[model samples]
Structure formats: C-alpha cells, structure tokens
Target: MGQMRLDTDPIVQVDRKPKCCFFFFSPKIQANRIVRAQLWVHLRPTEEATTVFLQISRLTPVTDGGRHIRIRSLKIDVNAGATSWQSIDVKQVLAVWLRQPETNWGIEINAFDAKGNDLAVTSVEAGEDGLLPFMEVKISEGPKRIRRDSGLDCDENSSESRCCRYPLTVDFEDFGWDWIIAPKRYKANYCSGECDFMHLQKYPHTHLVNKANPRGTAGPCCTPTKMSPINMLYFNGKEQIIYGKIPSMVVDRCGCS
Candidate 1:
C-alpha cells in the first residue's frame, strides 16, 4: 500500500574488517490486488566496488543454528554513481514468498574488488528521501477473487465483475514491537561487532546467523558509550518480528521449529 524504508549506520570503517550490511523486509500480501513483483530503489555506493555481491535470502528455522537460504543474488563491478538507481526483478521470489505466511527475508550488500576486499557504506539519513533504503511495488487485478475479498483493489485499472484468489500476499512486518529492551546490552554491541552470535537484551541475534551452526547461547559483550534509556526507547531498529504474542524466550534459535 505504501513505501517502507530501512536504514543503517553511516560509518563504513567499522571495528570489523569487512563492512557488511544486512537489511530485512517482510511484505504482506493484500486482499484483492496482484503484486507486480518488482523492487525499485536507489543504492549509493560510498566507494568503488570492483566486485560486489548483493544477495537476497530467507531465514529458515533450524534445530541448533539459524541460517538464511539464498533466494536471489547478483555479482557485479560497481562504480560510485553507476548504480544509484536500479530495479531488481523479484517477480518469481515475491510470488513464492507471498504464498507462505510471514517469512524472514533480507538483503546482504557486500562489496569487494578482484584483488580482494573493498569498503562501502549506505547513505542512511534520518528523514524521508534521505539515504535510507526503500522499495516500491505495483498492483494489478486478479481473477476469481472479488471486490469484497480483502477490502483492497487487485487491479486499480480494472472494474471487472469476477475475480479470483489463491494465497498470495506479503507484509512489511507483523507485530512484536510491544516488548522493550534495556539499553545496556544493545549499546554493548552498538556497532554489532562480534555479537551476531548471541541473544542479548531478551532478543534474538539482530543479524541473520549462520544456518549450519547458529550459536546457541549468549557470549560476553561490550556496551556502547551511548547507553541511555531515552535513546533506547525511541530507537526504531527492527531486528526480529514475531507473528503472534512475544514468544517465551527470545526466539529460541533463529529458524522455525
């Protein structure tokens, strides 16, 4: 129905050697409209990336570890302004994801050169039209499903009498922001250093863990200097989203049981 923007840090030279950005989005299907399945956005590369890997994946639950399955990917040589505005063809993947219930999906933007590693940072600003990442979708009419189906229009251009429905839908996010986290643990890994392996502040690892061997317990962490209650309260960083009520334990491992 509208656009959703997700932003990250501005610093490219993080404490970690390689700068990796993990972005997540959950698209919920609408009642009557058909999804066009395309994502358009502007990607600003802070530096030249001789070779880059842009991967889109889904997180699936596992017994011991949490991991993401690669759904779509791209490798290319990037110039600073060459790919500012690009369109990703996601028709096939969007259709598949829409069929399932709320699923975890993400974009991993990693850049490097033929010789080896490279550096880059996404331009994330605080306001709309800032460097924050965003996406847009188009909707058309469907067959069999009618106007009364989900109270939304499948085809804005059509006034058809008969419509159809199959279970195709998407959601940007579903509930689960009710609970709050103490600022201490969050500030500890403010830059998200090596803490991607643990569940802190009663929350799952904010990053997508390795599917083959997701770390089971919390590890020693360091809080950031900006640990304040007010700062933590207004922070809109979304790590994990739960479909129903907050789970008993911070998402016991990353994949579905």
Candidate 2:
C-alpha cells in the first residue's frame, strides 16, 4: 500500500463564478494493482443546515471546447456552523489515469442548490495543516514469488556439512535502500549444508524419488523447509509509504529435499 499528498493546489476557475474546483494528481502505479484511491477535501461550515448536491466529473477535450463528463456525484447534508472532511472514492478514475497517463486532464467538482454560504473548497496553500485537498491512494502487489537467488550461508573452515540454519543479518543500508522506513537491518536466516542419503530419508517422497532414479534425477540439496514473512514499511516506485508483509523472508528450518 502507498499514499501521496496533493502535489499542487487545486485550480479554481472564477471568471464565470461557477461553483467548481479542478484537481489533478500523478499516480505512479499499475492500474490493475491499485486497491483504492480517494479525493479528500474539507467542506467549510455553512450558515444553516442544508443538503448540497455535488457532481464530480472528468474533463474531456473536444474540437470546439472541453466538456465535463460526469463520473460520480456525491450528496451531503451540511451541518450548521460546523466544518467537516469529505472523502470521495476515485479508484476507478485513478485506474484510467494509470493506464493512460496522457488522458489525465483532471477532475472537477460542481456544487449545486446551495444558498447563502456556498461550499468552500480549500487548497493546499490556503488551507490549514491536514485540511488541504489531497489524494490518498493504496495499491497491492498481490502474491510475490519466492526469491530464487543463492540464499545459502557456508563457511570455508568447516569440515562437516549437514542441513543447518545460519544467522544472516540483512542490511538494507548496504544496498543503499533508503526507501525502507523500518528494519534497516534484520535477521533473515539462511540455510546451508550438505544433503546425503541419510538426511534425504527425512522426506519420504524425496528419498524414494532419488532412490528410484539416481542417474536421471538430480540429488537433493539443503534448503529451507520452513519460512516466515516479515512486516516491512517502505516506499514504492512512486515514493509512497507502504506497510505490508513480505513472505518467505526468514528461514526457520533447513532440510534435505
């Protein structure tokens, strides 16, 4: 999962005095992986309580002029003399933008049927801390495949080689991984040792397979039999913070299979 604040202040068109606010965001992730995206805005307190109908639309340019294509609209009952935060689901819109970045013209918010005090749209520059309009996005990478690189730890001085787990500390800093927020270094144990016929007996299927076809099949080697995930807080390619579990990061047990 990743999140990003609004990069620029929302554009307000006031020549015709239309109750509209246009916003744009650069989503740097795959459309299929996006879990959700939201547009957060602050609705200022009104003089009296009333229902406000708001239309959220995407801008589409045409030969003559651009048109506002309505995507989804929201209706909210404004509280008298009280300010509130409004969040609009824009997951679908973000998907389109991610797939076709060139079509990102922006979105517009149109408020209708409001008297006295109209809806107040806050901008990042004008609004107070945390009240500025922004977009919150979340993405999922789905199931990650197991790493296939060499994860075995061995010693040169050791004479005996048996299936065993070794302490291996993974330091992200050594790789210049500044994106990771926590666990600069962690214990990600590796497995290393020899696997002979005696140890292969632990796994009945592997032993039988090796015994039946010794010349045709390759010999079993020491590998991780049990592994656990690690909770990681890091930034994605878009520079957004993501907190999730990375599977098969720590080897718990080693075996010949």
Candidate 3:
C-alpha cells in the first residue's frame, strides 16, 4: 500500500506521548513482508543543547497472565536544541520488528546533558503551537519465493520463460514434485483458457488440431497442464488448466478406447 498518515489532527504531544496502535501488530502490514513506520515531530529546545534519544519500544502481552515486560528498544539519536520539524524513520531503528505479532509499539524520548543532569523535551500538551506531530506508515508486499533441492520446487521456468518455476507433480496435494526441468531447456508452460464446463462431455481425447496438422506447430503440444504437455479436463468438474477454453478430461471413463 502507499504511504498513509495514521493519527494527524489530534497531534498528541507530551513529555511522553506514545502512539498506542504501534504497541501491537500493525493492521497495514501483511505476514512475512517488510514495512516502514515513520514519525514526524516538531520539537523545541526545553533545555541547553543536549543529545535526544528517540526510542521505539514495545510491550508484549503476557500469555500466562504475567506482568507485561519491555523489549529491547530501537533508538534514534538527535540534536534537538534548536526548534524544527523532523521526520524520523522509526523503522530504521526498529527494523526486523514486523516479524513478531506479540509486541505493541510506543515512542519515548530521553534528553541527556553532558553534565549528567537529564532534561525533558517539550511535551505534546505544552500547547506551544508551532506545529503538531504525526506518524506515517508504509506497507509493501514481498516478492514470491522460489525453493530448490526441495520436494516440490523444480527447475521449471515460468510460463513467460522469464523465471524458473516449480516442477511437475502427479500428486495434486499430497506428494512432492517429481523432477526439475533443465535450466538450459527452459520453456514456457502456460495453461489453456477456462474450461467449457457447460460443455461437459466424455473424454473426447480430441486433439483435433494436432490430428489435422500433425507436422504443424499448432496442436495439443502447445498446451501443457500442471502435470504434462497434454492438458487435462475432468467431467466431474475436476478439470485442470482451464484457460478460457475447453479444458482437458481425466475420469478414466474410456481409456483412449
């Protein structure tokens, strides 16, 4: 998804203003994906020049009804003695945090002076009114994965011959893939169109085009199903590779007789 503004107008600011939604898994992000969360804050120097630490911390809900504990924090160091609006990448500090669904997020800051006297920054409630602060979040989907030397993944190139694909398999949902196709001989294995379910007939074994033009390059060999070069469609609606046309059949009703 595109960048989105979370809490805007009610720009809550305080010596300790923490966004609560961040404490938990973000609804914007999906599982196993990468996302960036940002905070836009307008701050002014409440004390002498000092180092400000912007900490991204979280609280986890105890499963055993125990006390909630604080996890390691992601911190961003900044010099904020001067008044200015800064956009901070909370994700840069808290990268890899999206992997967990257990923690809730909040933002906290601490000001440290060279003399060791800790100071506090302007709170959201100060109502000084230079500008309110807000947070923005961006979520993105990750790329598809390819597994090799596994039970299922193979050396099959994608239908577009652009990338390698998983190999052919007989066991629809149970068994693993049989073998991988050679990368050198990679070929496009696009399926045919949608099956003509309304024309559910017996196993025609009708390679009409192939029979008409045996030597031509336009025939059954052109359409390959999830299994092999010969596409298959089933009478009982268990058809495969229905690519917007008549699908193949596999009921064993007539064994090519």
Candidate 4:
C-alpha cells in the first residue's frame, strides 16, 4: 500500500495548426488491490525545425478494448529536432486488479505531426487517485440513419418534394464529478464580493467589481477551491459529494459545481 509518485508537465502548442492535446490521469485503488502502473513522458522541443509524433492509448472515452488485454504500446520519433530534452516510455502491463467500488480510470495520449496530422491529446491515471475522469454518455442501439443522395427524375413523383428535417436534441444531466488536481497542490484566490456564478460565461448574470478598482469597473471573478490529500469527487447538488477544495463550491448558472 505504498508506491505512488506522479509528475505531469503540460505546455503544448503545436504550430502547423492541427492540435488535440488531452491529459487526464486518475489513481486511487483499493478494493481488490493488485495495481502496478508506470508511465513516463518528457518530451521537449518547443521549436528547432519541428518533428514530433507520439501515440499512447489504454482505453477510455467509452472503451476501446484493442484486442483484449496485455497492453504495452509505445511509439516515439523525436530525432533531435533541436530544442533538446527527450524521454518517452509508456508502459502498462497487467496488475490492474481493482474489483469496483472506488472508480476513476482513463489513459489516452495522442499527439502527431510530420504528415500524419492530429496533434495533442492527453489522459493519465493508473492508480492511487490521480483523478481525471468525467464525461460519459452512451445509449444508442438502433434506428439512427442519415444517408442522402437525391438527384430526382424517376418519373411518377416530381412535384412532391418538400423536405425539411431538423431534429436537434441536447440534454445534459450528468451532474458533476471531475478530478484533476495539481496546480501546485492548489491555492487560488480572486473573488472579492458578490459571486453567484460567472467564470466561463453563458448568459444573463453579470455583476463583478474590482478588476483593479480605479472607479471599480471590471466584472466577473471567482476562484477558491482547494482540498486534495486525494479525496477527489465533485458535483455537489446532485450528490456524488466529497470536496476539500474546488473553489469552496458555489457559483452556478451552469458552471463550476
């Protein structure tokens, strides 16, 4: 019950325009305990001439069983494109034996360029509450069809063509529980007075002062959520509760739990 050390440094901006960067790692296991996970990635080449391609995936974002088990995938091609600093070793082989009751799991990192396109994608979490797993919606089995190609003129019906089909349904009721803590162990403050919700804006609720307070004019600000000795589980209102610091939770209109 003693072996947990994780380090992550994410600073990416892939120039040629196509970017897809995501890093999410969740570690916290002890139900049947058999965990043994190790992942190390340190690639630095801000710019020298440019050349970087990396891909690592161990499932998540709705499962991809990639041939059932024994997964240990690695692909690295950092041929000294100059700015120096390279080390990529992604390893995960067996020992993930947690039989439920303490969940949060996902590991997916995909970054590419040098003709293959796509650049930026991150997902990290192997065990011991590294936390970063939120976004799940799956319910589609039958009758979902949309394939059209009509150039008309088949005789019998030429005047009965009036098509207008617009069916858009967006429903979100997942009600929070996302974990990813490592902002230097957390310590953020910037919400002087009235803050009910406004930190990523989305409609009619704005009233914040002190942007520097010359005559008191710049609006919106709220930040103060901290608590992580590794408890991780946030979404307090629909219950999944377990908070120590997430800005002290209270700023809603549809943002920040």
Candidate 5:
C-alpha cells in the first residue's frame, strides 16, 4: 500500500452569494505508488433550508494522452444540522487504475439552491508527486453570450453588412483547459434561405450571418434546430485538437456524456 498525503484540511464556510472553496496539493510525492485517493468535505449549514452538492473527477493534461482517469467510487450525502464531514471515496482496481496516464488530478465540487440555481463551486488537484494543490472556481450569475465573425453573405451590393457575421466562442479557463472553434457543422439552425448553415458543416468554416440563430430549425415556430460544429482545442500544459462531430445537437454543453 502507498501513503496518501493531504495538502489541505477540510473546512466549512457560508456565503450569501454562494461560492465554492478550493484546496491544492504539491507535486513532490511519488505518482505510480498511489493506488487510490479520496476526498472528505465538511459542509457546515448556515441556514435551516441549506443544502449542498458535490462532484469529483480527474484532470489530465491535454498534450499527454487522450485518457480519462476512472473514479472507482463516488458518494453524496445531504444532511440537516450535520456536524460530521462527508467522505467521498475514489478508488480503483489494478487494471482500471493503471489505465490512466500519470498526470495532475483534479476534483470539482458544486452547490446549488433548491430551485437548482448554482450557488457555489470548489476544486482541488493532486499533482503527480502526491501533493494536493487546489483552486476555486466562481460561477457567473447568468448565461453569457460571445460573438465572432461568420463570413457567408452572398449580397455583394448590400454594403458591408452583407459580409459581416458573428459567431459564438466560449472559454473554459475556469477548468484549466481551453478550446477553440473549428470548421464543422455537427449542429444546425434555421435561417433565411440566403444563409448557408450547411457551409459551416465542414472543417475550417465560420458563421455566415450575425442575426442567424445556429439553433434555428425550419419546423415549429420556436423549436430548437441543429447547431454548428465547434472545433475544441484543449489547452492543458500543451495544445490538443479534437476534430469530430459533437455527440449531441446542443450548444455550450460540457462533460463526456
């Protein structure tokens, strides 16, 4: 059995706006010796109706290898006036444990209101050397919209407005990774006949119009159509590009599922 070192101790806090806490580990311990790991979170209730939510996963470098670290076990608990800290165990068998490449490890914890509105988020990392390093990520209050140029206008006589377009871009820096758009239309939306939603279907493509909704379908009045392809370039310690059709037709959705 290998030794486990905790870089940060568990603590509790209360916030009106809701924020997640973080703990970080140092990279001084042996990597291969670690057979399994676990995290214990102590949630101290500040209000009568307070509730807490949590999530744990591994974070790998983009350039290292396209491998996902398997978490053997995950536990969740909700308690009223609970004094003890909740324990989350992450363990794996030999083949499952060794399948993942040796890299930095990270876990993400989230809390939400009764209505499912995000209240807080916390993150912790375990380095290859067995040192646990942590960083806290604060969630924004609401949805954010980003725009970029989509060059697909055919009206050369309609002034510069005919040639200018805007596309959306999202940055996942809070998760310690970054990706960019690629030319592909894995999803689709309804728009004027002149708008070429299909052009964005291929790689190295861009949006054609600014007002055009990439999610617009031609059927119902407000039904969500398909979406454009988004090239994801992951930036861990190095740059890794994933060029493929998104599994689903939704936009801005994350996670392997």
Candidate 6:
C-alpha cells in the first residue's frame, strides 16, 4: 500500500459571507495508478444541536482575473462531536486533477445549514500535527500478476523430503480480526522441506559458493523466492474504513537460498 499526506493553510474568502476554506495539494503520483483516495479533516467540538453540512468543491478558472468556478460539490454531514476526524471520498476528484494539472487549483470547503452556528475547523497553520487536514492515497502500477502454486508436494513425515510449497489458509475471522470487511480467509501458503545439491541448477550462485568452499560451507535452505499481494478492506485504528492492497501477503514460489 502507498500513502501520501499533505497539509496547507487554506485561504479564507472574506468576501463570501459563508466561511470558505481552500486547500491545495500536489499529488505527484500518476493519475491512472490511483486505486483509492481520501481527504481527511479534523472538525473541532461543537455544542450546537443542528447538523452542519460541509460542501467540498473543485475550483476551475473561468476568467483571466484570479477567479474560479466551483463544480461538482460533495456534501458531507458534520455532526456535533468532540474533536473528531472526517474522511471524504476523493478518488474521482483527484484523478481529474492529476490528468489535468492546470485545473488543479485546489478544493474548497464551506459550512451551511447551521443557522448561526459556528463551524470550527482545524488547519495546518493553526492546528496540531495530528489534527491537520490531509489526504491519503493508494496507488497501484497496474493489474496484479497471479502466480500459481507450482512444484512438488512433500510430506514432513517422509524421510525423502525435498523443498516444496504447501497450502496455508489464513482465516481472518478465526483470528478475531473482525475489522477486515472482505475476504474472511485467504491462501497464504508456506515453504518447507529441504534443499539439496541435486537441485543446484536452480540456484547457480549458491552452487558456485558451495563448490568453492565444499568442505565447510553450508547448503541453501528452502524459502519463498517470490510473493504476491492481496486486496483488503479494513477499518484502521482511527475507525476509518480503507481499501488497499497488502503486499507480500501470499507466498508465490519456493526455492533454495
């Protein structure tokens, strides 16, 4: 999984009566590689009983002067809380900014429908490190390569055992990790058995090393040589739901040292 965090003090538009906070982020990652993206903001505690609606908007230049037009507003409900963090889905919005860099003016957040209630928000300039507004992005190069379990299967009880890959299913539910929303279980697989000089052709370097010091050198042991990832959707420690790929979760191949 890949993550990026950004923080900047937003420019407040005093002209607009309603409070408007603008945040700018530069995502250096490729547009097509982004699998998931989220915008996180910390909302200060409020005593008001009415729910405040936060409107997230994208800014697009409309005139030669320093003016922009807001498009595609994403409204999020802000409930009265005790300094809590809120997450907003920004995958499509971020993709547009990456594809068209010129249109990446930034995002605007405004509070509405609170009568006269004051919506206090934390910013990078005035808030603590943990309370600052930021973003988390998950990126993937392309389609994942599926690798099958190949090679000989051996029994540990047998005396003529050799290096091999064996089945090992990991049950998340059995482990009491209910936070994982998908894939209650998966094939993790394991490597075991032994490594002998008879299969030295598979690892030429190890063969050469053992050949040079045949008297005292130790032989290679069975181990996993390649691994693959698994896509997971789980709740983080902050209780935020996330969907990302966990790398090296599956053993793909087994070989001698």
Score every model by TM-score: 0.36, 0.49, 0.34, 0.20, 0.28, 0.54
Superposed Cα deviation of residue 108, candidate 2 (Å): 1.3
Comparing 5 and 6 on TM-score, the stronger one: 6
Report the lDDT tens digits of candidate 1 across residue range 1-257. Answer: 22223343322222323232333334544523544444333443445445665555444434323355666666665675454433456666555555654442333343344555433223444432333333333454245433331321223344432221112122212334333321112111111223333223333343223332466433434222221121221123342211122222111111110
The better candidate by lDDT, 4 or 5, is 5
lDDT of 3 by residue, 130-212 (tens): 24444555556455354442112224343432112333334432333222111112223223232232212322354444356
Ranking by TM-score: 6, 2, 1, 3, 5, 4
CA lDDT scores, all candidates in order: 0.36, 0.65, 0.36, 0.32, 0.34, 0.64
37-85 per-residue lDDT for model 4 (tens digits): 4343334333334456655544322233222222444455554332222
| Candidate 5 positional error at 57, Å | 2.9
Cα error of candidate 3 at position 26, Å: 6.1
For candidate 6, what's the RMSD?
A: 7.8
Most accurate candidate by lDDT: 2
TM-score quality measure for candidate 5: 0.28
Stretches > 4 Å off in candidate 4:
1-38, 41-70, 81-95, 100-189, 194-257
Put down candidate 2 lDDT per residue, 198-217, tens digits, no spaces. 76666778778767885857
lDDT of 1: 0.36
RMSD of 5: 19.4
lDDT of 6 at 189: 88
Error of 3 at 134 (Å): 3.6
Q: Which sections of candidate 2 miss by over 4 Å?
A: 9-28, 62-64, 122-130, 142-257
Give the distance in Å from residue 29's predicted Cα in candidate 3 to where it truly belongs.
2.9
Predicted structure 6, TM vs. truth: 0.54
Top candidate, metric TM-score: 6
